[model samples]
Target: MSAPIQLRPDETFLLNVGPQHPATHGVLRVKMQMDGEYIVKAETVLGYVHRMHEKMGENRTYAQYLPNLSRLDYLGALGYTHGHVLAIERAAGIEVPERAEYIRAITVELNRVASHLFWFGAFVMDLGGFSPLMYAIQDREHILDMLEAVTGARLTYCYYRFGGLYNDVDDDFIEAAKRFIPRMRKSLKKYDALVSGNIIFQKRLEGIAPVSAEMCRKYGATGPVARGSGINFDVRKNEPYSVYPEFDFDVPVYHECDSLARYKVRMDEMEQSLRIIEQGLEKLPDGPIMVEKKPKTIKLPVGDYYQAVETARGSFGIRIVSDGDKNAYRLKLRSPTYSNMHLFDEACEGMLIMDALAFMGSLDLVIPEIDR
Candidate 1:
């Protein structure tokens, strides 16, 4: 439980921000104690979008529940699904093809780029800049097309199976991805000119609601929130999973620990994601995208298993306890947004409500990811 926020007896008034506010971007609420326009402290209220995802995982067979991962963080569904797939693979000792690992790396990085692009638009819009959304969505469409070509879904994809992908990427899919990288680079340069250096944007976010690295650690913050605070930790680098270890990329870090710093981390991260995709396409080997002669029945060994993957928001972990059944006996999802969002009650105290909202946007939360 979070420490209770001290409230002055008569000076502070309670204010509720959203189970419907546009700035929140989802069904979430925060109870705030305010001294006029300044906030004394906050308490995060959840469960508005909860859908019993963990319970659903427990009720369904491994293959039947695969689709659930995509719904957790739809913008970064590939990353979420990757964790679940890897956890099962580890527990069952199923061998994924070399080509499958390469493809997973490519698709997940593409999804990361798409996720960051959407966040860039929404975040700038939160601070009252609207034009970036137009530019970002335009670039994001290219990736959606590339992924949809093979994955067959634009948003909530169930393209990854237990051992490998649901299907292999054709030459046309590879060509489309290759073409997108340079176009995306050009688009990013356009974004920098239009939003990154704007005086209004910088002033609005520059020193507002700064979260120190200690606060980030205390809250178990990850992804851009932690990276903006100068913690050089990325699951791709620090933990090394999938073909991520085989690729060359840099993790962006900023010491400002403010909204602008978080913005910069994600912006730079998109570029790094492009690097991963480029390397993946170049080194992609010619082999199967699924394992040969897989088991007919997908019963996991009777034990506890876990896998963690870095998503667009942060580190997403899947834990499952199997009783050697086709379905998990118990399942737990550790979503980064849940931890990152909790930091708001501590980090945003004393700031103006608008500034606090700005910091919340910087965390790049997907509320379903939290509510699940």
Candidate 2:
């Protein structure tokens, strides 16, 4: 009889990728099960920086809670502020002024562009590119300048009031945006040439982390993540609110369901956003920036209401349960990143650690947004 064939035992190792790792973008700990460099399993352990913003909001009055919105997604403060104010206005049955709505829309779209620009730079940087970050920042600075002129703050602007905006966009702000839009479009072409066609970037991202449309819906993915998987479910399109119904723009979708698909979706979204901004500028009407009947204190009708807005990362929903009081009985925030991150557990299985970082970066997570 031949000697028994020697068998090699399967080996497994454990690795902790972050809490401080550069790839995480924020404080996130990913427990990884690895067979060599390939990750067989990955479990993201959050709550590292959780602030419980919802609880804080519930305890504060509507006017007092306005600042908390900026804390949720500091990177996209305007979008967060807009979501909260819009929800409160809807719940209280308040009528926001027409000019105020236009200003809110413009600021939110500009913030969306800034958020996407940062994501574009960071995503490429995670994949081993650097120059795009600098180029993207150059455009983002123009947005910052415009926001600062009206909001008086750069990163965390608390400019959205319950029934309208805190201030108006002056002629200078409009002119700056008009000048910046053409420059941004030109810069986008440069970005397309820089990383979109680079052989190295394509090799790393083209077919990696493919998530099907069914999986995306099941996992509650939104924004570019869902759009990347051929799911056309944008809040702006599906449930139009504010002045989005007046804007002419396409919801960019990709059937590829891979990293490249996500990249393309964001690129296309930037262009669509620019179109929205241009339309908003042209049709912008002149009126009072604040409601004529501004309330001294906000008190909503006793009921529950939800308002959702399309942020740069995904769709953000603010649910307010009012008890006919100045303070909300319950304030629940359904953050897009919270649901989007759920896909990571399934998507990261069997992918290399490096690829996993690329995949996570593609999701464009904001830790506070998830934790809140």
Candidate 3:
């Protein structure tokens, strides 16, 4: 999916990075206008993995389109499905069970932690540190195993239903979750000592690619990218979806606005996610996972319905225009990666290629989600 490099007048020469590079993490190609290792300008070229998920949403019924949510961001598929289901549920005026909401919150937070773990490993690997990736993955595997047992898929989960989840959790799932808390806490300490405290790692990221609050506002950036700039806005705290308002958790923010600042934000967020999961698990009520009242068919009234959820990457929103039918008249998926990636062109300008890559890795992009 690599594209041929194009020349620009401002550059001495062009360097094509990725569309196949491991540092890119996916099929992302950056056309860099470079002058002797310094990047004068940069442009991100996407569409390599565009699946047209929005088009698919128009063709399929609400129920039939449920599985496609996973294809957007496989690492945080449950969040996408959660947004889609909530959008439809609101449009149809359906009430979700309390226990089901708790389970949804628990699973989503677990998935968010898994995503941050994966990002931590890959980001370190980008900076030429490989050993930490192994440690990160080792901890991430436990989360994957726990999620797989309930969702029936390790990644790209479609376990959520319109009214509730497709299934319920057992004592084993709860026990595994409780066990992971302390174990992951120990791993976080190790990661801090091993990677976060490393002199070379700190030097590479500390002051590199500092994005200002104004830049984030211009690009409509959210999640850690915005929080790193001290914006102090989280969809969970700002919008309060699902049962997030009931739990006690902190939204991590850093005013430094550099790659290290962004890194710290995600690192702190993983711990907060653990706190949320622990709270949800302790207060998990005993009740039916699914609502008893059922509509014979899923249909949305003619109106514009939008629901947003805070995914691992950022705010993921599903907007639907219904015509009083089972299928959507129009569908729009507002993905966080798209907004986050928008800041890259300006952010990467005038930086060295290596630092630019570090900044890119800090964004934690899932290209398919942006392309979709």
Candidate 4:
């Protein structure tokens, strides 16, 4: 009798990436299915740093909850705080004073610039470049200094009030932002040379993680991710809340739809934010920084309101359901990164492990934002 033919079964491997890995940029664990070095499937396991922020928000009063927003995206604390305060004001129909709106606009733009700068640095570092991170952080420190003088804190700034800001911007803060603008413009040129034009960066990201416009819409991606895919849907442009209508700036878009395209979009956004800051400084009007008629306590009518603001990461939505009480009955935060990370499942398939990390980094997942 002829011997039976033997065949080898295909091998599947399990890979655990993170909770301590640098590519994660935060505490994220990705369990990947691999056929050799290429990933066949990827699953992201979050909640390593869950703080139960939404549940906590329901228990705290509107003013008391402002401090918690910053903890979501600590790198862009002002943006989170701005969105939360705007939500409360919108829910209660509070009229923020003109000077207060301008100040909020200026400071939020500055915070956006700072946030993008950090992303620029970290994105490059993820691709095996390190020097840009240091340079970017050095420039970002200037914005931090200006923010600290006004907000009294560096990272988690609880500066926004219900009807206005906690305080008005002093001349010193305005002068510092003005001085920082031109210097920042010049520094962009240096960053362009340092990372943007580098052949290595281009090769690593050129065609990796391509997401079509249709896919972005299906998944509700925002900020640079949607823009990179040629979806011109920035909340700042579409919704135009909080003095954004008064400013003239373009929402940067890229048709490339790859990691490289996402990188360029964010780099361009920093320049556009700088322009907004400059215009805000010139057009800022003098008026009361806070509404004189604001009640000592806040009680919204019994209804639900959804407020969305363009954060450095993407669109941050705050939904509050009030039972005519000082504290919200229910509060929900729709974090951008949580939705954006959903794309990683599709984007990382069939890519190498390193390429998957690059794709993940490009998504800019702030673990806290997702877990919040």
Candidate 5:
């Protein structure tokens, strides 16, 4: 996904695009060698947050390490936590009740929508459009209010347990969630009308940064970054984890392969998430959320266990190696932003600095996960 950087030693000078730049969304610094206004080469500098989540996973017991997963990509915390819990559940041979899996799907999809909503505002703001932030945050508060009522925490929710949820949702939560579907649908229409067709917005994004399917595959990109380039892959559909198989929804793909395509993919994904939540509500079974015969302690059989789940940014994977002990021998995380950020060097070459920032926005990066 990269090319040989043809540096113009005499004409070019270095410029830092981050560390404090609003466009980065975090403390990610991009070192760029610029030839006048065009970038000659770019290098992404990470390690701002020294959060050693992997090492922490090895130090803590399987059950005790739950909270750490929620911090990696705080915006899509549930999906990352979902992968960790799913891996542990698989390793321990625990069976989650049918109702719990449905709840997981519903709550994670709500998290996904919230993630996209924030990204919508922030991404637009990154490109110098300010009003969208107000509107997007306004709509996102409704989702946050609902999530807080059930999960008891909003942003980095550690709600999913090894084989079930922290607790069963109340009737009030269910009714509020049901009402949210239509309200969110109306909100989405308002967003489209307000932002999608705006000439300035379209001009700023469409055809700005084009990614090819070959390039995405080369860099191992997933989620909207790959789907924007027409790669038909989604962990919920392709891998079929948890209750995702029971639900019906389409993986939104756009062949345009530009910034606009990535934007459309996330926007459409919110609606699809709504569809999933609606289906989950309708088919929500009556049963205990946790297994009846639950063990007091969890010990993974000596082996390697892994699980992958689709998050807002992309697929977040967790791998645990255990030696028949309480603590994991080793833990590894496969984060999508790392791979997605890999495309920046090649994607930004020869483009104007502002356009390069626009391209980076399209990637929907969550940098803390990259640091992990």
Candidate 6:
């Protein structure tokens, strides 16, 4: 327990939701002022698990920082890694191979599905629905196995090198991915019947803590948080990178702006990700997975270079300032979780404490991503 806040007779009292609360999704604590069951104000208190990822980037060699990106958002590690690699590749003017880009797209989409599956399960578990978590995790395990086969790690993968991926996708990996997609589609239908159609779940989320398009714009929220509010923007579509431009997919958006809208956005995005992966598999050309004649030590031009990628949670960006050295002179990370989370102060006002938590779940926060 934290030190109790002083309260007046009629004034709202403070409730510390957690630095360890399971519903928080990660090591996050929210200091909320409550009048009965209604929240008057809410503030997020971070820095519990800070590892100084930006500083680590500046201190370590460019290649050495690859693993640090994964630690920022373990659930969506590959996306962060992709962003970092893209930044380095752009700054160094290194060309990634066509096959490599396709491979990166396939693996990253698989990772996205895995991350969303975990979120779906954990988010439902936060609302006292336990069975969906089991179902979601069971489906997610296949994703982990598939990623582990290629990346050599189940979580927090650093599978991409600066110019390309660390390895190529083998026939076994491709065959396994082909089998996983249809099964995942079947699982989504079951999830709709189990959680989406549940009266209690619907009542808990519908119209609760509605976020407006203006509010998302004010806070720089992106991904499902912004899409949930009818903002038709996606980094993959709006700002195409890698081989995403070659693929055909839809960016799902909902106009409702409520917790349900946010929930549906993610639910729809998982299907779109599957489509991207399937196309990537079909269009995967025969070529080297890595570029040859690349510099052993990365030395970017003396300027700032930035790259952004659509991760499972939202847009993850890497900005690097280089002085033509092997290590970064200055490094910054623009994490979507930080932007999406800032809206809570405004969105949660006057909401029930439980509804506020549901709203937080809809944002799909990964705390390390925010803290980094």
Best by lDDT: 3
Q: Is candidate 2 or candidate 5 better by lDDT?
A: 5
TM per prediction: 0.97, 0.97, 0.97, 0.96, 0.97, 0.97
lDDT accuracy of residue 212 in candidate 1: 92
Pairing residues by index, what is the TM-score of model 2?
0.97
Q: Name the lDDT of candidate 1.
A: 0.91
Instruction: Give model 4's TM-score versus the native structure.
Output: 0.96
Worst 10 residues of 5 by lDDT: 1-10
lDDT for 88 (candidate 2): 83
Residue range 116-182, candidate 3, lDDT tens digits: 9999999999999999989999999999999999999999788999898899999999999999999
> Which of 1 and 3 is the better model by lDDT?
3
Give lDDT tens digits, candidate 6, residues 68-110: 9999998988898999998888888899999998999999999
lDDT of 4: 0.90
Among residues 3 or more apart in sequence or in different chains, the pairs in candidate 4 whose N, CA or C atoms overlap within 3 Å are none
Task: List residue ranges in candidate 5 displaced over 4 A.
Answer: 1-8
List of clashing residue pairs for candidate 5: none
lDDT of 2: 0.89
Q: How far in Å is the alpha carbon of 80 misplaced in model 2?
A: 1.5
